[model samples]
Target: MLKRQEVKIVGMGGQGIMVIGQLLAHAALIEGANVVWFPCYGPETRGGLAECTVIISSDEIGSPVTSTPDTLIAMTQPLLDKFAPTVKPGGVIFVNTSLAQPPKYRDDCKIVEIPANDIATELSNPKTANMVMLGGYVELMKPVKLESLKASLKEVLPEHNHRFIPINNTALDKGAEVTSR
Candidate 1:
């Protein structure tokens, strides 16, 4: 188990960036870890910059803001450009290959390219791209169990949208499948 882990998820507004951070925080709480989730976005409701910073640890957190993340998930090219340098050495980065290109070669961090939008499109729900990236992150990091993430969906998603649970679950599984290889 990680003593502490800081993550930053960045993408355009309306891409469910906040949801991914919330899901991770909820799962961490369920596992008895302390978590802090902070979201920031531009004035525009959509097609604007949005990002969430999530810190999970077994001990009490010192601060909610993250200047250097242990893990960075970039869902857009602009996000990738903005946050790639902020990842600490030995950290990992997950890039949405469908919408953004990987950063220039960097020996300080590991980069995992994921075609999240393409994967979600193949799943018939492009909105699920965030969930796919989250799934891959879970599988690669093993910070929380897959089952715990599944269970947290009920709490993270609103009641009116409960019917889409199965599709999101499948998206998570598909993402895990990609990372396991």
Candidate 2:
């Protein structure tokens, strides 16, 4: 079991940042870890900045907010610039190379770059980029079981949108595959 883990996901407001965070939190819950998810966004709902912080641990959480994250998932260049320095040493950063430029090389932490938008477009949706990034993170860190994350999708997604579950699953799997290679 992980003693503690903190993840920060940042991107444009409509990039499904919150959904990824919620999915991770729910998956951690399914794994019986204490978890907290806090989301923040700018005024505009579409292009404005948005972010979510998720903390999962085996013990009680002292706080919900995290200043330094163990992992950072950035879907935009600006977001990456703003949060890259806040990652703890030996942490990991996942970048959406389709939209954001890669961060400067840092030996302290690992950087996993994925062309999320391009991958999603290949899947014909272009919106599951967040899921792709999330999948890569899951596969790289193994914070929670892949089965648990897949199962949590039904709960995180609304009933009416269940039709897209299969596609989202594919995106996640593709993400894992990309990172594994």
Candidate 3:
């Protein structure tokens, strides 16, 4: 069994961090990989700090908590500070540069600051920052194909909101392209 890639996504309430975790897990599933997704759901309904841990592996998972994640996506400043130090050596941090500032820690981990909110706003959907950041994270990780992720999104997103799918997909692609450069 191949080792799984662990990702910890952190954000405040209403950031759709849980959905982002789900999308990543589904993308892994589409690629025939094993995935375990667990979200800290309690007391998260009133603008509280929330996070979700996703493990994507070619083998079965061991635990839900990732002490040292291979990658971290922070959508808020506090989250960035709280989780930045926990990333494993040689790990990556996908930062929502629009919300979180650059961290003081500058060694071991690779940090990529992306203007997720700005890009989403430009795309006419401010709430799509999650998808935008997902794109950037995927580019940084390159664990799966971009097309596979998009296909998973199309399947997972609500049916009535299908019109926004193409826009979100483009946002994901834009983020991927920018980060991969």
Candidate 4:
């Protein structure tokens, strides 16, 4: 059986870190997995630093906060410096290459650098980096099915933005394809 996975996504303000947590939680819920979503509320909610954690488990979750994580997705430079040390050994680290560069340290964990923001910009939506990363995570982690993710997106995204779903789905597929390599 696949073990439950804990993921921590850290980024500066306006990076959609919290949305990533929510999306993961929703996807996990659809998968019939126990889910916990936690976000770090700060004065910089607008221009300050922000972070969110999403814990997906096969069993009941204990707490929403996580001091350690099975996976770390650092979307900014500060986030990379702050939470990179907390990632567990053999865990996966998905770094946003657009804002945050790769870390210098050599850890035992697997690290993948993705230009999610660039891809999102090319897709004509700068805010779609989170979705791009989500797609990449699905491919890299394989924690949940892509079909499940698409269904959740359809349910969660507003109806007026329905036209953008296919574009976002393509972004996800692109991200996943690159990460799968």
TM-score for all predictions? 0.97, 0.96, 0.93, 0.92
Which portions of model 3 miss their true places by more than 4 Å? 1-3
- How well does candidate 2 score on lDDT at residue 165? 92
Model 4 lDDT at residue 111: 86
Residue-level lDDT tens digits of model 4 in 137-156: 98989778877777777777
Structure candidate 1, residue pairs in collision: none
Better candidate by lDDT, 1 or 3: 1
In terms of lDDT, the best-performing candidate is 2
**Regions of model 4 farther than 4 Å from truth:** none
What lDDT does model 3 reach?
0.86
Candidate 2, 1-181: lDDT as tens digits: 6879899999998899999999999999999999999999989847999999999999999999999999999999999999999999999999999988777765799999999999999999999999999999999888898788889999999999899999999999989988888
Off by over 4 Å in 2: none
- 10-73: candidate 1 lDDT, tens digit per residue: 9999899998899999999999999999999989967899999999998899999989999999
Query: Least accurate stretch of 10 residues (summed lDDT) in model 4?
Result: 41-50
Candidate 3 — worst ten consecutive residues by lDDT sum? 41-50
Query: What shift in Å separates residue 108 of candidate 3 from its native position after superposition?
Result: 1.5
Model 1 compared with the native: what TM-score?
A: 0.97
Displacement of residue 84 (Cα, Å) in model 1 is: 0.3
User: Which parts of model 1 are misplaced by more than 4 Å?
Assistant: none
